[model samples]
Target: MEFDLSWPVLWNGLFWPLIRLTFFISVGLLVGNLIESLQWTRYAAKLADPLARRARLGDISAASFTMAFFSGITANTMLSEAHEKGEISDRELILSNLFNSLPTYFLHLPTIFFIAAPFIGSAAAVYVGLTAFAAIIRTMAIVFSGKFLLPPIKEGCLPCRLDEMEKKRDTKSALQKTWARFKKRLPKVLYLTCPIYTLFFVFKQIGMFAWLQGFMSGSASFFTFLPPEALGIVVFHMAAEFTAGLAAAGAMISDTSLTQTQVILALMLGNVLSSPMRAFRHQFPYYAGIFRPRMAFKLILYNQVTRGLTIALVGTAYALLMT
Candidate 1:
């Protein structure tokens, strides 16, 4: 066997995907950004104060819950400050963080859908759809839990500086703002997505995923719930992030004769299993650093359990329906 090397990585895996991704992402980002700027105002946090109040959170917590939509760190920092000030309790902290789940998911939905629609194709909708539904369920659970499990606030919420709070507004016209956001987000999406897409394709071409498939077959009984073809995707998800896992799932979707249901089930299953590790790696440290250790641990635990259950519920429904 002769060794070959000459922009193989660039031409072989990256070229078409780069071209396809560039066009789709450029257009999608523009459209998605415009929609975000024009349609949804950041005042959702202020607007959601009533719902948050019903859920037993005070003004400060509700405000933080709203801030979560734009920036989780901002939301979380506010939560920490409120916690330090005794405005919210441990229970409120846990519930509020969970309530922010939907917004946090929404925060990235545009980016994920726009990027995925092209890279992952038709399957992108299904993959994003299931998670969105799951996020919705988790949000519902938080609301109900807050209403039933926690007591409603009697004392007025702290006098958070609502007057000083500001929403991000661009001075430019919608088109200019869209163009600016599109340009800003485009490189970031491509930087993350392009390399992952390319690497996954190269790995597939060289048969890394094939080995994973073969490896999983011996233990197929372990994943009896998932279709045989999806085992590789599950493995990839368990080992890496959604980018690699979805990339693998997308390849199967585009190349193999796998049906949409199979792809959805596979990706969902991967999502179900992989979330805990992600929580540990990302959520755990961030929360611990910001919140007290025990509080962080509890918050992370609640979120992981809630998220896992939500995904599992969706996956079960899909599996049963498919069967």
Candidate 2:
């Protein structure tokens, strides 16, 4: 069947993607800034003493991982800033960020399941539960490993000293500070949103996504001998944002011959594979400015390696348990 390419249909497809992206990006900016001001700053201050070096390392690692797992884009920016300020060394910063990315896999599962429930019926519950369980397990693994995984801090480097000239800000005024930060982030949110919306619409109108999905399908078939639906999902995932990839996966869930476990595995794999591309498209420039290109590359590579190993191990265990 020839798909309709009418203006109305195009507009309909573009509407949700645009709205969702803008809303999430805006929320990410506001909430992210507030999180930084309150929680992050306090954490930094609490661990600023020389005696708390080990504790500081763990806190930094956990926080970086939490942010990455929950929200990669915002978390990555925060990590870069943290590294620049020397709160953490380049190596530690990268390891923490990478470790956190794995947990992010399960972070969005609840929302994704709720959104998919209407279409997939009861099976949505199973998918959501399994994915959430996987994420929790991964989080635990990282936490346990964090005790030994992080390298020792350099001797004589006083715990990220706050200069005497830099007076502490009033933490009690959180609401006001949050509002101010939100206002400041408004322009940046719009800056990213406008281009993202425009590109999303233009791609939809040109049928670019379909062609890209087709290419993915072909590749998946060639490599994994999987059917079109699985391949299409993996492809959409690689080529587009998470929401777009999930939407494509949802569309094919009922029609595909793959088992539930297979579908979930495919989706998870797609999420992992898409990370580097997503980082390159959105984060590289920001990080490049703070750290030299070589430093940025090393940081990202370290992150990917750590995250990849964590995910592979955790994903294998999850698959084994489910099977």
> If scored against the real structure, what TM-score would every candidate get?
0.66, 0.54
Inter-residue clash pairs, candidate 2: 65-100, 69-104
lDDT value, candidate 1, whole model: 0.69
| Best model number under TM-score | 1
Poorest 10 consecutive residues of model 1 by lDDT? 156-165
User: What are the Cα lDDT values of the candidates?
Assistant: 0.69, 0.58
Give candidate 1 misplaced runs (Cα > 4 Å).
1-45, 155-221
Question: On residues 1-323, what C-alpha lDDT tens digit does candidate 1 reach at each position?
Answer: 22234576557655755676557545545544554444332244457877786777766567666667777765775666557668678888888889899989999999988876765688788778888999999988787788887886765433243433354545367678777865765566556555555555566567665565455434534877666668777777666667777777778778875777887787777777666655654454345545666777788888889998999898788678778
Model 1 TM-score? 0.66
